[model samples]
Target chain A: MDNLQTEIRQLIIDALDLEDMTAEDIDPAAPLFGDGLGLDSIDALELGVALRKRYQVRLDGDDPSVKRHFHSVNTLVELVRQHSERTA
Target chain B: MDALASGRPRLHRMTHEKPDGVTTRNTTLIESRGLTPPIAPGRMDSFSLPLAAWAAWPTHAPGCAAPTDSPPPPGAVDIAFVDPMLRRRLGPVARMALNVAHRCLGERTGVPMVFASRHGELARTLAMLHDLAAGEEVSPAAFSLSVHNAAAGVFSIARHDTAPATAIAAGDETLGMALVEARARLSEAHPQLLLVCADAPAPELYQDDITTTESAHALALLFDLHQSRRLHVARHASSGTPSNSMMSLPLADLLAGHRPDAAWSGTHARWEWTLDDA
Candidate 1:
């Protein structure tokens, strides 16, 4: 879980062109959008694309649970882990 | 020629001056580089530099020639004033426009803005098209930002300013048309208008169709209606040669205190521009 959290944190920074940020700057429990990282709808879309490309996991844009999956690094780590386990 | 003969807004001229008196308001070239300095007149000599250097070129080398890399990237754009989250999504063209616009606004808010570009968001549009061709899902963010008015819209959102903003693309006459739009927006109530003209070079596939070498560039001009120096624009016959958008070059020269009338041909018309002291 720790490794996955760090990897997802780095992915967010790289995919979003967060030039001033590093993986350590992202708190695992903090929200990825709104008051935490201050991300918006565009970042969500870009991050979804990046995640799909990296994980080879299909993400349905209309899925309601996608919002919960993107809430924080901890949540994103679980989501990726589930997808990886399901595929494995 | 037939288009002109068919009464397509042909040979029209507009003059703007303060009705109350001969007011001399400040006209500042807020932030610009490359084509702003007086280069050799009558040629697109400034396009030879990399897009990043357009506004940074020294005035001492007026006509110094340099080889430009074909299909140069949209070089460094310093738009640190914009919020990082929002700024990260902006493409090169938007970054260029916002960089200049923010510099010109400089603490001023609630001003009307006119953004002019010959190929607004062309690069973004091309990228989206490629995604579609590859059977990839076009990112919703990219699609939304690919519009012509995306820059102006983003600028308004970033500033939280609700003042009127307009985007224009009129082929080679984009800059002239944008100035016309700015003049129309100016009034006694809104004495000043911010005009930004920017363009990124067309994508590599379309480079062969380009007439003159174009490099990415953006310029901001602050126009005060009460200014004593008035600009006169009139349409005339074509100069009998193909030309690209180079209005910003002469505009920069004029801003640099060169008191000379200039003329340039666009795709469909010839425009004669002169600045005179009222």
Candidate 2:
């Protein structure tokens, strides 16, 4: 679980060109948009594509339950882990 | 800059051309009417700040004379900005466009606008391909966010603006198609139209056609009903230069050094000025 989270966190940092930030800077409880990380909608879209490719999980927009999936890097890693296990 | 002596080829130059059935020949390329933004490179960091932002945000618009220190009350119009740093990390397509829209508004409040991106959400596209290859489940949020009009829609959100917007992709003729829609919108109620054309570098797999990587920039035009300056659009007979090649002549050739004794000729749009002050 720690390894997966580390890998995903690095992916986000590299993918978004977080410039001055390290994965450590991204709090698991912090929001992705607005004051938390200042990512706009485009970032969300690009991040979405990255997650799909790396985890083999398809994110569905119509599912309101998906909100919890992106609540933070921690939440995302957990979701990906659970889904990957279920599918396996 | 040397006239003909030290000529280095420009990466891209717009040329004029006349296709069959395209009769118009004398149209102006761009209208430089509004409070002209300074050409200085350092100050205007965000390629995409709105007119009010240009007028109001002295720290952003380079060389702008500071507005009298009083803060002006907000109005119906709003400005949206996307700086190059964000673009390099995020998506360059929309960032290029938002730049032109920012310039077109100049000092006035720009009307609600529609922005078009021929290749939208490029970063997402690449990431999606990577995910597929890895056999991982794609993030649902990424898939939903990768739509073509996502940039313009995001800009609308950034400005807290509910103004109507449109996103389009029309191949190599993206600019021409965007102009057609902009003119149509002008026929409606909006007094000024902010039309932007933006495209990022093609991902390696898709590079066979869209060959630009240095970021084809955007040109924003503020359309005014009573404004004196006007750019008439027309197709011109080709100067024999191939359409696929970028500009054949350097801008320095046009500025003062190589001012053509006669009319300048190319395969793209040209700017012609007619002011009463003359």
Q: Chain A: TM-score in each candidate?
A: 0.95, 0.88
Off by over 4 Å in 1: A59-64, B1-75
Question: Residue B177's C-alpha lDDT in candidate 2?
Answer: 44
Q: Residue B114 in candidate 1 has what lDDT?
A: 88
Error of 2 at A2 (Å): 6.0
Looking at model 2, residue B218 earns an lDDT score of 38
**Over the full model, what C-alpha lDDT does candidate 2 score relative to the true structure?**
0.49
In candidate 1, residue B158 scores what lDDT?
87
Candidate 1's residue-wise lDDT over B74-164, tens digit each? 3456777777777777887788788878877777788788889888878788888999999987876788888888898889888888878
Score candidate 2 by DockQ: 0.21
Residue B68 of model 1: what lDDT?
38
After TM-score superposition, the amount by which residue B42's alpha carbon in candidate 2 deviates from its true location, in angstroms, is 45
